[model samples]
Target chain A: MYIILFVKISDVGENTLIEIIQDLISSSESRPDFRRKENLILGIGDDAAVWKTESGLEISTTDTMVQGVHFSFAYSSWYDIGWRAMASNLSDIAAMGGAPLYALINIGLPIDTDVDNVKDLYKGILAVGDKYSVRIVGGDLVKSHIIFITIVIIGASSQNLMLRSEMKSGDVIAVTGSLGSSAAGLRVLSGALTNNSEMHKSIIDTHLRPTPRIIEGQILAENGIRAAMDISDGLVIDLNRLCNSSGVGAIIHTDKIPTDRRLKSDFSGEEILGWALSGGEDYELLFSGPESIVLSVIPMMPAGATIIGEVSGFNVGRVSVLDPENKPIKLNDKGWDHFKL
Target chain B: MYIILFVKISDVGENTLIEIIQDLISSSESRPDFRRKENLILGIGDDAAVWKTESGLEISTTDTMVQGVHFSFAYSSWYDIGWRAMASNLSDIAAMGGAPLYALINIGLPIDTDVDNVKDLYKGILAVGDKYSVRIVGGDLVKSHIIFITIVIIGASSQNLMLRSEMKSGDVIAVTGSLGSSAAGLRVLSGALTNNSEMHKSIIDTHLRPTPRIIEGQILAENGIRAAMDISDGLVIDLNRLCNSSGVGAIIHTDKIPTDRRLKSDFSGEEILGWALSGGEDYELLFSGPESIVLSVIPMMPAGATIIGEVSGFNVGRVSVLDPENKPIKLNDKGWDHFKL
Candidate 1:
């Protein structure tokens, strides 16, 4: 909290990359969070991690976070990079309604990289790991240009793992937090909202430290929710991915899209709706189930899950957004892409 | 075979390091290696790997290979990188008398890395994985100035994992294969021996892709061999490590160090013995057992295991070499390190 942690991708100096990295990750290895299971035999110091899996089903997922491509070094810290890297993968497992167990990280540092940067990045990685009770096992260290991170997460599903294709026409759609804030945060970072101090902190925080919706994922899945996924590629695109994968369609109301505390309509509801629809980087789980089950879980929304849309098979893949006048407006599909560079 | 397949720590480039890393690992989400067992699934993919273990001991080790520092980039190709990566880890598993079940790889790629280099690296990785029946379950990739690789192997042992320290002063010493070929290959690569055109192919082959003695490790373990380790940091340094680890001493005969058929030397047997003792990268397994059980496996060594020394309790940390008339001579500690850059 004392220091704002953001590194500009463009300015990632190679001269001290390694030492910085070593320093960044050192803290994470030293201290762990509460959610770590007991049998994490070897965390960060060995050739590979050793684990003991109990009876539940083990699920695994890997994701890469690249500088400039995946995130802007503009106002991001090594910790931000580390946090989002693991958060993204954990989000995937959460969407499937699983309890995360372990993670292995690989870091590429540029020459002249300071060992401290490595430790800082790892500090973020370990903070997340500890929060989830996932132990930092074993990993490798090497140097490279433009920092690249790949995170693999292993989790356990108490129930059958949820798949995106299992949703039916009548399921109700819900999300584990508000959207558009992260995109707003990015805009502020790019200097579009350069002077708005209040809006800046709220939005920037959303972008810099997005948390995975692991808890809500469990609530929904344990209660029979079968189709879900993390919303990384704008809500509109992600909803379509889920519906299409499940052979269903959906109709979402723009008026119902959630918002942060300060958005008093400087932009049209439609524009804000579009941000929620096409903007990405919100590691929130989006799930759908029966209307009755959704209502029953509303009061118990696990610190985040907010109802955002409804599942109507008639609108599969083509998400229809109704404005205040209940009129359908066209939305664009723009999400993050590694190839953008 | 014209090019050895591995990126030495010396020849690391700067480029799309992460993409090339994709082919090296298997889809952990695909499924478990077999029917699920009740154990702690500690770590997966992230910054550090984590897991929990109960009623089990932890074993740890690390190794590093550089371009000119540890290998010549000219003869070493990506395949060699991949194979040696797996082979080196598997050798460690064998030394512990454990069957390798899982492996995690960490790779460093420079920005200029090509698709083929990446794929070829994975092919080598996968080939070795298949050979050892190891599931290339998880790993990470990054860009770096030097192409450095670190592989962490995890395996299970039904009995006490073998240690180098268990050898007593009277225990017999043995090696699994001939030495100096890898070193000779390095010598050839350095332009020290250009005229041996007839032996070029064989020597290079010997140096480029040396297989680890896992089967022999099994033989040693099943037949009750106690102290063991792979001869990677040279027989001299590695033997010193084992002795130091087990709090024991050792002495070896000069004429006993294994040598290839094409090898020729004018120096006394003790000098040739020096190269065999301290020249690293031999990758053969060094082990000790009761002289009686050692006799049973004598004929079983296809590459042949030679008795070189006996463990000495009072001299636990000392590695002494005897000349033709049993005269002692000073030796060099020729092991590899990354900072050699």
Candidate 2:
């Protein structure tokens, strides 16, 4: 008899798992099917998969949200859950500067789940779909012990594609809308803070129902902005990913980070700053371009765009945050990792 | 204080749930985005969602499989689970006479799952992907209490499309390959039946790794056969669905059902017939067309197609199975339903 050993996902972490997957895919490159197709513009390592279509390019993306891990029903209604789920996928397409065309939803729920709740979930999904002209084509519903929703969105775009690997040294980095409110909203929902003000209610709504920046992303793409990504995993972490992909570094000023003024009225500066830095789920668009082009397109943005930093060549893949005094600030948390120990 | 009551999914049943969904989608028809899209050929109620492309048609479908609900690790390896999940989506595309092009795999696993197991799962997915020249484009990995996999597949087909609503009276119903082995193999794995013969191993393999009838579906489509669907639910139940879609009915002879010779040697006639009628997960293509066209295409099928029944005008949306002596046999069980009380 022989003994067997096992290695858990937490032991190697999410990054290593991704690396292993890449390696497996690369190793199969010799196979005819795995060979790179001419029409496939991008695959595996991007916000959305891209391929050439008749007139332009087709974009596809998928996102999965698990109950308890992603959201809690104690604070989020079924409609909110559905809206958030569809929003996440729509945001991915927005990050790529693509307009969503169709979506297929896959839901797994317990048999005893309320029928009205499930219908409300679809209502929320349709609400977002209608806003962006995305059609709900088909889906699969299965029985499960825990609840989960997975949405697959297909979209279209012109030749102008926003990509993370296109960031260049000396390009200015900017973000649309505000951040930290969604994370702060979670703090309120978790009962870490107590507030019943109208401002607090708005913050909670921001967390529950996010609007993907479709028009803003299109404006940037149409105006020649090439390097961009959505701020899903916080500014510092996602900026680091963009830098790593582009083989560069960045220096963002904390004072220049755009955040909700209403959040400042309720939370401490330190608490708000921390949330803004590493608080995930803020579906704002973070993009980089030349200073002249970036400044030219700012006025066209609906939610307003702010220049937060500039890309650099030194300390590749690292993001340095500076205070108003221009001194580097150290961060305690790295962003969200599904398999982090 | 205010009180609210909830109606559980089991309260209305799966059919009612689907009808409710249809009502919701139809009610939103006034919205500009919800209006009929010119390029969309088929929308909600089918094996796959279809839309027109420049040269042909594009097909998409999604399926979700939850651990314990769909499969258990006690008998199945992670590799088998991945293969089955991908196979389900592939079979959906095949049912439409489409050739799969790309796939996005979304996996939700417990944090403590073994890393090697996940790799084996990908290996299994890639094995099937490589067989059909399907490229694995992108996916999302999330944390969950229960392991689940959702795969979204995109495929393409020529103008000739096989649809469920195209069945006509006097059409001969035929199916590719044998059935009942998969359900029988599940019993062997569940320990309800004990067997150690070589044929038992083959039966177990059949249950573990099912091959979708892609070539057979395409041949039927190219040869002018129009109505078809995969035998995922039982033959009787799936046939009923075909009839419902076409506004017709069917009568299938139980004696004509093709079964594995090895399954017949080990299991009773009643047990084998029950599995064939409603065991589901067979992944065989059940199709109907003119008798001459169906017989003409039989020579092209790799697995040898068998004529099992014929479509009729009576008993719309109903399926009747007749015995060898011409007596009607009553079925105690319908096909698989996620929410059946």
Candidate 3:
């Protein structure tokens, strides 16, 4: 039998790896539609990337994803990994009511990884970046036994910022678009359920390429919505966090929680509600504001918003969910915690 | 036999981990001398941190260090690891002639790691930040099989920026402070050398806690020096990078290279020279400029400057070293490449 050998990163060395990455980035940056921002003084291949700043508030956030913990290649492609990573950071900026400007990506890969896989990852990152006009300014690459990606994104806000601590007890709690679908989609990927239907494909797409509500977040912030956060670690935990920060509590009407029609048809009522309430990674923006203001901004949200909860003054940090019959619903799980035993 | 139980990160969970980290940061931030910048609109405990910006150029860079690859706890304390990581990014900002303003630290720890070790790491990070007036604005903590730290620093610079591509022929190449001490120190820590004297302690400190030449870099840029980069991957390789970026060559006088006096007292002449030329992690600034401008800035550098080479027009991207007799010296190795086999 003929032997086959695959080139590893160790064979080409770090400098060559950097050159390869630069080449990949150059190709993406050279696209006809890829416009370079005038504020950027220098791009990659320097001691540090440089950019000019306008007089405004800047938002910065960082997120890290590890292999077998945050993601796995068994179902998720490298492209999906990159897209998801960028989307998470983009969602953070959106949650802060900011427009993403630049990003710095740091990746740690096993030396045995194929260089082509890295190119595919960069392509995925560029795809989402192009969608939002976010520029890839600089990044770091190193060798590790296990793969990981840490991304830091810098964005600009128009003075007004939506903060979690701004939530008032009288405010209405609402979320943009549907939830539970991404969690359900992840379940499908993890082999909990299998079907070749179009709905299944849609759910998988939701899990793999969730959209960041940037414009909707900005609209809410501009329309006088003072408090907002992305539902990444499920509504229960994140809402509790917002409540804790604001020294308030919340009450949710379970029946009013938004979920995809397909999700309701495919899963049991309890399962769908559980995923919607506690299964995280939806990337939908949850916000609180006065009833009138919240209603006024509903028309401006592209994904639409559904009011499901109300902030309360009693029992700070407590989130009580009510069923259709108005009885308190008991949930077994709170949300996703990376280090929770 | 006695059995003992230690606290693992999994026992405390991600949320508690965050609270612990916040407490640690709060303690450091509350120091009497720690003055918060007015531009920082919001610090931690938000979806994303917010900071107002002055109208100027911003420099951003990221660096990642793996556990076994970059450092070993046997020789490097958790505090040193944190300080060194920050210093690396600070050096990058310095190389761009920028003043560090904020840092975002991302760390990945094994599930079994002790919580106290992480506190030590943060303490180390805070110490460095305090020294340079760089604020820890935001960060992410994640669980991984292997430990790692990725730091992204954002700095503000005047209109002028020192770039690697700005070097030209006939420029005098100078470096800040002495080199080789860090490498020599590494050897001592690795057990290749044995020493317990005060000189050895100084060398070890040089290897562990390197001083980034931030002020020196700004002085050079203000004095009209254009091309500069930090010697991270050794003088030979870094010089070649500068040469290649500028499409020029360089010639170095080996005897002119600087080394710590204690290093020479402890190591052989050849060993000192070898480490000075090819040993990485010096964190010293290597710059090229007109002879007059270089000389004029030398007095302003806190660590002093030594002219060791000159940019040349011949043999583009090649770096040649000459001995006392002016004969060419051949190096067995170039420099450190993370993925080099």
Candidate 4:
């Protein structure tokens, strides 16, 4: 077989992610052939690049969205794809309590792509940029077999940045909005929409118009709630990650969990429970903080938020699904894994 | 007749660049789909995102080098491609006088790709990263039709970051190294390499390994350089942009221009002059400073460096070339364009 390796020579899609990433990390960065600059404060580390900011503290992050794997323009509008790219990366900044400022988009379009389609994609990107007051300054456009958008967002922060590994024992766990709407939305868009049409409307919207919890992030940081991350890959899986990173465990209460009405009925309490655990695209914040801070912020969640669990010390990472009597039940680890999927 | 407006879609056969970056970026951080944190100083922009140093001042930038467009893996080894990507983006950060610290990479792989090929490519990326003391902390990987490597670099700066739009009138102009070698290399690699094997070594190296001007950026920033940028895009285009942005004009001495030896016999001084003005990938520093500062730095540069030009007040926004007798000589723009060859 004349197969090319990590440089993308697949006739069909490939699935060797970890192996490929390892190779990329193993490469060199030196080149004596060219003159180099020395002002780069940080070239390639951390959640977002930390650069020198003359005005506000600038935190930068880049996200790449590709067709087929990420979304299908077949069912999703060109505008939706564009908006999704900006919104998702924007959330990363918001998670760190930064104000969005500028964005650059590097896009690859297939030759068959229509000009209107390209413009529509930009329209969506610009819409999101306009919403956040982020300017689209520069980017690259190229030809490719598929359509891809690489977005870079630069924002400002004054407070200390939040990291995933800061959750402590006795901290309350909460999430903004409801869970499973987006994961369910994906099902519908993928032509597997199981819920009724009305339910599908809300579900699809949840998936298509995911709202980054920027305000919630600011409030949490302001109130001294430090440990947090967006729950895109199942709440359970993400909570497990946050807990593990912080060296803690979580006890999730079945009744206290938030579920969109679409999920509340179409899926059983247990299935919904499972979905809540394994469903990706929740787009809700799963955060842990001191009880006092939670109390002060309870009234501030505009659409109502849920305190689903608490952080506690555990030898091995574990999630407790409690009954009314608070007994533990086994929850399946069914969250999205790009590799296995 | 529908046609893509960009180039670099051909095959040089090292690794094909895939377009999976689409969903990856949109799904990361936060969006309507996930919870977000709020302390992020920057999400993404410029060479890298800027963040309030968890401790000190820092800056960062990222560039994605796709196969075919950035390098031809056939003539240039995988190691060279990795070296160039690192040098290219780091050059941007270094241009601002930031200290290099970390480098992160996201690699896209094709499933059938060979293990050895992946190893060589990464070794190149690593060689450069380690030389600069930049650690590779995190990255992502996925299957793609072609190979695309996106590199993020973090840097540190104690001084104000450099801006390209800050040049002034009467500032002396200078370049750190010779120009046209890269394009000359391109000429050879693009089937122009006949029997002139001995003469084309520099041309080959110039194309495969244009260095990032890290030291020059620091020196200039430290020495009070308000406006500076590396010569990636051609000199005429880039300089035109600089002068236009700073609201000034510029003049260059044709005899003072530095170039590869190959060009001397093939073209007239004026023709070669045009190449110096436009043929890019020189990876040199084209910077402007006060007359005194420019003269002072002349002694500091190796003989390779030259004072080929100076900022002018003769016109509000134009670049004029002066021949040996100091008379203006009109020349056609000969630099590379993205859409053009």
Q: How well does model 4 score by local distance difference test?
A: 0.67
RMSD of each: 12.9, 1.7, 15.2, 7.6
Backbone collisions counted per model:
110, 0, 0, 107
By TM-score, is 1 or 3 better? 3
Per-residue lDDT of A159-260 in model 3, one digit per residue for the tens?
Answer: 677887888998999999998999899999989876778899998988998898999988988889989889888999889878987899999999999999
RMSD of 3: 15.2
Q: What is the lDDT for A34 in model 1? A: 17
What TM-score would each prediction reach against the true structure? 0.71, 0.97, 0.85, 0.76
lDDT of each: 0.63, 0.89, 0.79, 0.67
Candidate 2, A140-234: lDDT as tens digits = 88999999999999988878999999999999999999889889988888887685899888888889998888889899999999999999989
Docking class of 4: incorrect
TM-score of chain B in each prediction: 0.77, 0.97, 0.84, 0.79
lDDT of 1 by residue, B46-119 (tens): 11122334434333222334344444467688888777776776777667666665555556555555545666
**Per-residue lDDT for B113-229 in model 4, tens only?**
665666677777776666566656445555555767777666677546566667787788888878877777777777754756666766777777776777777777777766777
- Please identify which of the two predictions, 2 or 4, would achieve the higher TM-score against the true structure: 2
Give per-residue CA lDDT, model 4, range A29-135, as digits (tens): 33453334343333332345554444545567677777777777677899889988887887777666567765657676654555556666876776666666565
| Model 3: residue B89 alpha-carbon error in angstroms | 0.7
Label model 3 with its docking quality class.
incorrect
What is the i-RMS of every prediction? 16.3, 1.7, 19.6, 9.4
> Per-residue lDDT for A1-341 in model 1, tens only?
49854443213322233233333333322343312234443332211233444544555566656576566677788878887787777787778777776555656555555445555677677656556666444444444445677665655676455677777887788877888888878877877654667767877878878788788777877787777788887888778778767777787777777867575534556556667777788777788888788778766776566666677758556677777688987766544432122
lDDT of 3 by residue, B1-341 (tens): 99865443334433343454345445544555544434443243321122445675666888899999888898999989988998888898888788887678888876556555665687677667666666555677787889999998887777667888888999999999998889988998888767598888888889998898889988988889989999988999889888987999999999999888777677899999998998889999999999998988899999999999899999998999999889999976535556544
From the highest lDDT down, the ranking of the candidates is 2, 3, 4, 1
Best by TM-score: 2
Give stretches of model 3 more than 4 Å off: A1-54, B1-54
